[model samples]
Target: MNVILITACPSGMATTFLGARRLEQAAKRLGWQVSVEMHGELEAVTPVSAEAIAAAELVVVAAERVPEPQRFDGKRLFRAPIHQALPDPDAFLERAAREAATFDAASANAGAPATATPAPQAAGGNGQRRIVAVTACPTGVAHTFMAAEALAQAGKAMGHAIHVETQGSVGAQNALTADDIAAADVVVLACDIEVDDTRFAGKPIYRTSTGAALKQPKQTLETALVDAQVESSGAPQGGSAGAGGGARKSVKERGLYKHLLTGVSFMLPMVVAGGLCIALSFVFGIKAFEQEGTLAAALMQIGGGTAFKLMVPVLAGYIAYSIADRPGIAPGMIGGMLASTLGAGFIGGILAGFLAGYSASAVTRYVKLPASVESLKPILIIPLLASLFTGLVMIYVVGTPVAAILAGLTQFLNNMGSTNAVLLGLLLGAMMCFDMGGPVNKAAYTFGVGLLSTETYMPMAAIMAAGMVPPIAMGIATLLARGKFSQPEREAGKASFVLGLCFITEGAIPFAAKDPLRVIPLAMIGGAVTGALSMWFGIKLMAPHGGLFVLLIPNAVNMALLYLVAIAAGSLVTGVGYALLKRGESELPAVADAGSGAVAREQRTG
Candidate 1:
């Protein structure tokens, strides 16, 4: 069989490539000729030639939105959402082969391409709702597109007209127009970072995290339908109002963790860029940057002097922005600058952000003005009052104590013995793997990142090392005991390995979701082992991200070979342990076996 596979996602990051790889692997296993075209945030990678498309027996589109569907007119087409192909690509392929229909450009409306235009009402029309959604994450990589796809799939399944705007690393795609927003019955913001919601005024809005939307799309939508509150025209952009005219707090609004995570997310790019530049400066020798008027010195100035200088301010500003929207930014940034000047560091910056955010929010809420003067609240009144309050409090009340604490903490960490270092590594490692990419993982990550501004590198090294273990270990486990996993799991393990190498811990999510009891403990154990070993070896990392890839930059990682060994040691422990303990499909009871009949059938057919 000749198969032309088309895979795409909103971000064209992890999911796009994962789906393409899975399907290609499945096709190869079935002894079929496969040509893959992948669409992502960037240009399509090695698109299938027209000759190949013409000769293909089947066109399988595993995408959020099929681009240029007219190209497949008159061909047999099998279209499924990317989510469907992710976990069970082999089964997905088998189903495609069996159920593919001839594509007619005119009749199918060119694969019903995703557009700002609203989808036609479902047949029988009753209970239909028009939904507009925006999905964003701090990294703007994996979760953003995943949540968008999940919501799109769920909305389709529930007979709702839905349009999703993805705010990712590449910025917003499939953006919602004013008409789209106006037509929507409700707006869903599945974002880990703060998103501007002013455009959604007068519409019912429901907010959720990308994880929730990805895990339980239908339930999220159902909840949104029931609990979504109307955005009051008179209220501030980020604030919300219920039907009864009372303020409604969302997950982002109520949780200090979310606000902190938002800050961390916004701060990450700065850390990575600054850290890498500093690493690069070291390539010219550690003392090279001390000599001015050179590239190395310039790199240092850019990385350490500018980027690092702004890092705390960006973190603080965004944290406040997450809390109180635009009104909180000025005060937050001013407070962060004060924190840096006072030598209070990231901890002080965090305090400043919260204080400014709450102060601004309080002012926005309580300091009502006449209609003629209301325009001045956010710009003039809020910033002036909030900044004054935050700056004064930070300098007078909080600065000295926080600076002392940070200095003590830094001194202790810098002088800690191997035993203490190992203990700290173990704790951070466990936290990194605990929930993969959830709050616990982000907490550990944020801690490590915070230390970077203080020139403390070992904790960051351990955090990353621990984070890389779970996915790589899962990959190793599948290789060690293939029979213990399904075909999809095996395929996913290959991708997981690659993702792990790049330090994407979320690659282990599918494995963990399937068997958390086994996967999570094993991963945590592996992470702890890696973290301990890295610390024991006295490894130091300059960059906060890029996993093993960062090692390519000279001096980015000290003791690189030992770091690899530490990672390998942890991966081996997890892989070997899980392989030994995991149960094979054949070991399942009758009930489980019955439940797996469809997979068995698909395997036989393949």
Candidate 2:
């Protein structure tokens, strides 16, 4: 019988991939024809097809995130917990096979959709129904999109038409449309913050935390819609709507960097704006050497002060936006502007924005309401509350450390020299491999950019060279020594080239995270050696983002030939050592780690 399985997790990188591998082994052992797909970044393999789903006698979902609730409308489904799939793969396979022996395809087809209110829920094939949803988190970083993708991808794996919207640091992506909303049998809002528009007013609405969507989208979505039906059918109920009440769910304890991610997401635009404005002023405005005239000075000042001023508000506003949605827009902008005026710049602006938003949210949540309260959310409540918080933070919190850090970082860069440059290189390179794009990586990167002002460009070159080595070497070694890594990892070699040039050190993280003993130390030694060598050789580069590709760009690097040597040395060590220690399917189960889904996914498509 044809079978399709969906694999997903919070990160969709390692756990999902690992799960897919487990499922594959399970399917192979049973001699079952199975197809698998992921709910993550890489394009899906053997994506679920209508014919495939129709032909399947059973559908197995190995996931953390749930797809749309209706995908399994008329199918025999058994969801294997990702944990079970990852560790005791053989046991889960046996369990699923035993359960599949009991599928009642005929009865499922005869029933109405698993869930859906009669009034607004649209009917699907053989009385199946579909739910459409949007998932978001405060930082717009990990959970927000993972929730959405898991639902959509999982739903599809279950044979449902699922569309997703992601509220990420880049803003709303995969945006849901009016058509999408209208066609949905039901709408689910899985988020931490307030999403815009109450357009699904008459639709059977389901509101849940992102975790609910990830782990139990189908159950939750079904309850939400069916509960609405019970309510509409005159079932006596509490005054609240759906499973919740007028009060919003406060999502606490998400991750260490969630709030900070929101602040940074909000702050980036301000930097872009201010940086561009200042850069432009440096370009077209009066040069200090060209003119001493007052009008020339005025033009320069306006460019620097005017367009640049908008930066803070946008930064703060977006950070607030990331957290509270539309409500965050006003206070965030105002607080950001206040921060700039108070001499805080972007850092202060971010603090002011977050403070304004959280306080404004608290004020909005409590402080008893009158009939005018609805209007006050926009007209009065937000501004009054945001302004007070912004004012306080700017005067005290935002102004102090924000100002000092900015000053200190700038001073550090300005004074970097030939003697210190080599040390700086080692630091940046090591950081690049430590966590890839994490906070440590950011600090090192930010420092490199900081050095641009001081005209000390070598640290960036070392960073660039070091960053590219791990992924590239890891990729080459896998290709050169296929027997050392698992079948799943060998497949990942397909994407490693692109990651290598882009300098995404985390490309190697899946292997490293899972097999740190064999992988990390070797990779680190390689990285450290490369970083030190690049600096000692005085390889210099501009541009903080690009990797070896930058050398091809005109005049991007100094001592370009030596840069290649430095990169090659690191890459070789990382590649050879990683291959030697890489794990096979048997080895994977031995490593117990957090975020099981990520490990699974990385095994398949890392």
Q: Which candidate ranks first by TM-score, i.e. highest?
A: 1
Clashing pairs in 1: 12-40
How many backbone collisions does model 2 have? 24
- Number of backbone collisions per candidate: 1, 24
Measured on C-alpha atoms, candidate 2 has an lDDT of 0.61
Residue-level lDDT of model 1, residues 1-606, one tens digit each, is 888888887544457656777888898899888777765422214456778788899999997555566788899998888889988888999999999999886766633532212222221245888999999877777778877997999999998999999998788999999999988887899988777776876676788787767656887786576557664545555423211112433322447877887888788888889999999999999889999999999999999999999999999998998888778899999999999999999999999999999898888777878878777777799899999999999989999999999999999999999999999989999889887777678889888999998999999999999999999999999999998788998999999999999998888877765555577788899999999998999999999999899999988898999999999999899889988878777665433333121232222211
Candidate 1 achieves a global lDDT of: 0.82
Estimated TM-score for each candidate: 0.74, 0.55
TM-score of 1: 0.74
List residue ranges in candidate 2 displaced over 4 A.
1-155, 158-161, 166-174, 177-246, 249-256, 266-313, 338-346, 366-377, 396-401, 416-431, 434-469, 485-488, 503-569, 583-606
Model 1 lowest lDDT segment of ten: 597-606
